[model samples]
Target chain A: MERGGVTVRVLGIDPGLTRCGIGVVEGIVGRPLTLVDVNVLRTSASVPIAQRLVTIERGIDAWLDEYSPDAVAVERVFARSDSSTIMGTAQASGIALVAAARRGLPVATYTPSEVKAAVSGSGRADKAQVGAMVTRILRLDAPPKPADAADALALAVTHVWRGGARARIDAAVAAGRTP
Target chain B: MERGGVTVRVLGIDPGLTRCGIGVVEGIVGRPLTLVDVNVLRTSASVPIAQRLVTIERGIDAWLDEYSPDAVAVERVFARSDSSTIMGTAQASGIALVAAARRGLPVATYTPSEVKAAVSGSGRADKAQVGAMVTRILRLDAPPKPADAADALALAVTHVWRGGARARIDAAVAAGRTP
Candidate 1:
């Protein structure tokens, strides 16, 4: 639909300080077709934890700039035991949003459970299951490594299918309604 | 000094809820040169904020994979106005640390004052002064768009100089030991 029938691209981000996973998918909703890029970003502890987050942010920005995504989808936070860990999670998420917004791109966010449900058909889907589903869905030659990458792909797909009024539809489906 | 003579690459992060600024620099402490990347990450009010954090974390991870930074650095939290904001900041910081540690990277931290002095030659430097100095020192043609990106770069360069025992050195410097 955009620029002579090039399918709109959706960039999915799986946030974290050390290992951030990103997946780029092409196509439209109700049929998220292919996974273009699946990769993990890494950092060394010697640089300081906060620095690593910035390092990750820079990488994501570069990716965004290169691709010019139509929309961005990210996975939301999950509960963790440590207060410090949660703060890092929130900060990373903020960075991703700013990156997309600065480019005047719309953004969507999905919860861990919701992403799991959409991809795995179960809210409690584990990392491995989600990875398998992502691989199968994308028809990749190999499963994405570093777990987070697969999760990122799922978030992007979830946003396309289930974000916005799709949530309402899903809720209705749960209630056994067609509308 | 690297096997491939690849300039030592370090990624610095400033993790925040409202924004996370990230920067990457290559070279050793005193001879630091090149700014590979600088960017801001963002999210929104509508999405459950917690889930947003996770997406940020994953995004950072993907960046790390692409860049393969030698080390990661992050800014230390100083103070904030709101209690909820502080809680969120703390949680985000934790996630940043988790990313670094999970990757077996030795994480480091630098306080705001330390980062300011490193870049501006003033411990209590303001945002503009710090931003200006970062642009000057890094030879950036344009002032980094968002304040957070500049701050993240400062944190990274600071970590390069005095992240480990630099605090003690800074205190000594403050005592007029060295100019």
Candidate 2:
């Protein structure tokens, strides 16, 4: 596929304590997005919280160094009834944000609904629907294994479709032009 | 007063996004504790979450480098009705943990009640009582400023009192002697 125009690469993170999904996608709006990479970083629950956080940080730092994405996207954490799970997710998300920010890369967070709406055209889309749409959009052989991995890819595609537009508007406003 | 026997240096962090409290205390169990340092690291709420986290990481790294404490202590975060506040705190605490872990320092988390009990003889002690006890324990003329700073000192004192005893037991067990 002959690509033209500016390609914005984004690294997306689905943050979790045990299994953090990471994916990178490259493309601009209205174009076929290319999958750069996808993987999940896991930390042992038996380890201390501090050690687990360190492992997550190292994994994120390595991804940032390898891909050198223009921007990083992370799933925004919400308070859930399960306090322990939510706390772990929030902590993992923090590591991702700090890793990207330290590299001076722009970082953005999308709520689950926002990501789903962007990828599947409906905020209320189920997991299977989102997975199916992601596979179709990226032209993948199959949906990324492990829901976390697919969710991460969906987040990247969402950023490319949404954040790219927002960035342009921001650039225009900065240039003293109405976006 | 001249200090005697293995003094353990501990840095305690009361993590918050807006104002993170950091304090260092050095002492052995059953001895006068010394306040080495105390301060609060503030990040503007108007800043992006990623930027705030980066600011916190830098502040923590600086403290770790300067104090070189034997261990790091952080306050355990609990879920509250105010989701936003708890989320920010969880994130900040994560940053503190990773900062210490990255330096290969041992990290421990003490609950609020544990800290209160360690300092004030009652698990339900109020903030004022904890502050008064900390001031008296460290033999300081006044309580640390900004409540957060005082709370941080309290956490360090709690860890020094508790962790020191636990360490001795662990060491003795490692030496094949019943603690």
Candidate 3:
């Protein structure tokens, strides 16, 4: 099998201000597998408020450097109450996109429902169910810790499952021309 | 002391698209002091663009809720070469400011040069020097990691040193109560 064509490594991340959960997985084409590493990363705010974002910036760089996955997958914000929250989330998300795109990697996004569905066979599965299914699907001894890690893995799973289907459909629609 | 004497805990954030450095400081009588705690946060494009921001939003909320910082100090973006980069930075900074202000916390801003001067003897001091000085002034264990963290600390230091001064001057001017 061709190197690039056969195997793909993916990084999945869950974004939050204080903590961002990250998971990395390897996928083989035509195989319902690919599970690798996972971790829960944190950022603190005890310093002056002005520097918190800078703290975040450094962390992302380290994450990228550490994993260097083939593709990046992240969850999309489903809903938020506060306008301020939505705005902040938007900014952080932009940085994530910038980082991935800069590396010339294919980046994909999955919604909460989509990730849950992929992992748990239910779009509205609760966090615990998703975590359990993640363990089952990946054949792990237990679900990843702190919940966020499991969520990140589910996002990676969703991307691996859906990304291929979308690519093929887009190719078919374009009749071999770039979209 | 009057209840409305205006004690603002301004969380100053320096926005870097990749790093998204943040600093949280409390402003009393418009004078801020850097709190001891600080660190790097990370996110990746493999997540949905919106999710990354959500992470940031949550981080800010946790800080605000925990410290009850009265206002936020944000470093304004000077023009950048790339339109997309500037646009994203502006968007992110805008979001950070809004998140604080929307919660009835006033927001303030400072420029990069201004932050440098406030932290270091010279506005053009190199990053290492700035980092060294930041550690010295704040009594930090080491220079904040990943240039962005240093930058974030710089933003906080600037806001504490200069943002407070600006706010007081602005308040006096607005009230026609100059000393």
Candidate 4:
């Protein structure tokens, strides 16, 4: 029986303008993932837009520097829904991706449903269900707060359980194509 | 009257994932503008997402280093329409904002209508009209190519004219609040 591969640390971002949720988890697939940290970075709407983005960027930079995650996962921005928040969400997603890329870490994005499915085994799972499952999976005292934080942790867990495998396959294919 | 205010150089970005348009112009509000440079940074959708962002980042960095614009103007992302490209647009916009923020330059965003109104005197002016007006304002031999470049120039021009006044007002308010 394989004891799985090396444990991978992941930082997940639930991107938003008002509150960007960030979470870090470490574990190998099929193993109990340890919750390293989870929190939301908040910025006021009154500030200039560029300054708001700077706040998010600073948060992301701090997390990346602290956790030193092996990979990053962010919620895929869906342009069809939530017209009001879509732009801010997408902007946050870009900041997350760039932070990971600058560190040479692999970056992946999953739709909201995929994160729900990975954590709760239902693509249509509600936020409460996903939060409950995340609590159960990490064996935490309580579910992460603010919903966005829970979503971030769920994304981290999801990427470890799913994106990790896909990343491995991608690497192998890239290596194969190399001369 | 006092020959307008100080000359302001603006780097305007028409953010797009496939082709980000960048332009630089220098002028004082209510004065004739001088065209500096206009070009598009191309990135293929086939490349990895992070890599694409890096390309845009690099282009912005180079432009900032070369031109040292007094401020940056990016077209505001509107999420209500164009679901197909909204995410990419927002992401590109984020990169632009971050680039300017890092350089300690003022970053401003203008809605599409505001840009049209400032450049062509009609809020609902079409792209061709904006482009023609941009050419006339800059006294160019021809309008910048690929429309996106022209739009970028128009944004720069708009920011110097309309946004400059707004920015001054904002600064005054900020100063007034500081006690």
Top model by lDDT, which number? 4
Among incorrect, acceptable, medium and high, the docking class of model 3 is: incorrect
Ranking by lDDT: 4, 2, 1, 3
Q: Chain A alone, TM-score for each of the models? A: 0.82, 0.91, 0.81, 0.94
Q: For candidate 3, lDDT tens digit of each residue in B1-179?
A: 65534544556677645457776654343333455455555567555344555566567667678767655667776443244455446545745764675475656777776777778878788888878877776667888787777777777767666665676776676577883
lDDT of 4 by residue, A28-140 (tens): 98879999999999999888777888889999999999989999999998887677777888998888888788778999989999999899999999989999999999999
Candidate DockQ values, in order, are 0.10, 0.79, 0.09, 0.79
The 0-to-1 C-alpha lDDT of every candidate, in the order given, reads: 0.72, 0.90, 0.66, 0.90
Clashing pairs in 2: none
Report the C-alpha displacement of residue A5, candidate 2, in angstroms: 3.4
Tell me the deviation in Å of residue B84 in model 4: 0.5
lDDT of 3 by residue, A1-179 (tens): 55545566788877655566778877865576667888866656443233444455556667789878877886665333234344344444454554565576667767788888877788999999999988887889888888988988888777777776665664465475555
Better of 1 and 3 by TM-score: 1
Write candidate 1's Cα lDDT for A12-125 as tens digits: 998877778888888765554788787887777555454666677788888898877788887666444245565555556666765676565767778888899998899999
**TM-score of model 3 relative to the true fold?**
0.51
Ranking by TM-score: 4, 2, 1, 3
Query: Which candidate wins on TM-score?
Result: 4
